[model samples]
Target: MPQLDHGANALVGVMAAFGRFELQQELSGLTAVQAWNLLSPFLPLSQTDPMAFTELLCHGVTPAGGFAAYGASRALAELVGLSFDTPAAQAVLDGGIAFLREAGVPPMRVRPYEWDRWLDTGGNVESWLPVRPPPPPERPGITPLRPAETRLVAKLGAEQDSNRVFISRDGTDFVAIVDARYSDEDPTRARWVWHRASTLYLLYLQVGRSLQTPPHWVAAELEAYVPLPAPRF
Candidate 1:
């Protein structure tokens, strides 16, 4: 197992990797209000005023464009394997409907049969279920997998590579990398880190891993270790 200091260093290195990949850019620009507007339509009608959601959806004032935005956002979420009928989405839709009704805008006119057919054609239904398998168990006491585990190899050429192994603070067992992203220099490494972190977080929650607090160091390492997705304008 690597020493705690080494683990900490590795964590720092991974966070640097995330910076290099521009992970922060993905989150930096949007204001809270914009985010609310984008997400509000998806909220449940029962818990919120449907009119508000509908208005948000319809207020942009373009028919095909509005529907396209909604469709694209929903499709992307589905592709990323999120649920379609989530309370959040429902609420947003309800608000949009109400807004349109009040404005006397014609109903967006997606026939149920036609909508289903469109969804089928777009292959959007595949990601309707949000459940995913847990990541492989961290090697015995190695603690959880860090973002570095996904990127170090690709950054340094395999021949120049150094392996990072660690023992869990519990002082039992150890985790050694089986594989990871190519290296710090590889652009894809950052994204790999993000995906790896997301997967690990999900797995941790699914398996009920206990932590005294948020693992900031681990998060930093992940952001550094993997490439991030591009920002959405």
Candidate 2:
């Protein structure tokens, strides 16, 4: 799509290439009306000049454009593949919702259906969006995925390098989960760890078996390390 010339509106395609921080900074402190001011000229509402039409379409935003600024801000998310919320972009949106929530936007008198859709098809998008996931199970030695402060600092092998691993924050608290499976599955997943980046240079001085991240080859080297189970009683 061609770029428009209306301030940020002209940079619609540019938004696609921008990282989360750039996008967040692009829309940090704008009110709902002000934000859409950049969007309106390209909207159907603006029939006179429909230049940057694709901008409105990129984020799965429909013709409705309900929550205006919030909707447009959300439309800044990464919509390429799997469509997970990018950290920086999500931060700005969550801040706006937090402000409204503190203002007591939803009174207790309001029923669930008043906010949620009737059919329960996972589309209960109210003024706030990206329905929050339920809390994870509580367990010791593993920090709960809450507080929004959790960050992956180090992914260390669990005791014995087993199916489980310790994903820690700043080398301190950690949560145990199935290994790189935290990123992807076994057969379908293609993993390339940083074995050749930092410590790998020291641990493996020469280019040989020791200088590699394991499980890359199926039969070339895997057959040499298979351990049979102990005889059962």
Candidate number with greatest TM-score: 1
Tens-digit lDDT string for candidate 2 (95-150): 32333333333322123432332123342324332222212223112223343352
Error of 1 at 15 (Å): 29
lDDT of each: 0.31, 0.30
Q: Which stretches of candidate 2 lie over 4 Å from their true place?
A: 1-3, 6-28, 31-33, 43-56, 59-70, 73-120, 123-233
Give one digit per residue, the lDDT tens place, for model 1 in 1-89: 11222243332332233222222233445454543443343445313543433333333221323233343333223222233354444
Write down the lDDT that model 2 would get: 0.30
Model 2 Cα RMSD, 1 decimal: 19.9
**Estimated TM-score per prediction?**
0.21, 0.20
* lDDT agreement of model 1 with the native: 0.31
Candidate 1 residues lying further than 4 Å off, grouped into runs, are 1-27, 30-47, 59-178, 181-233
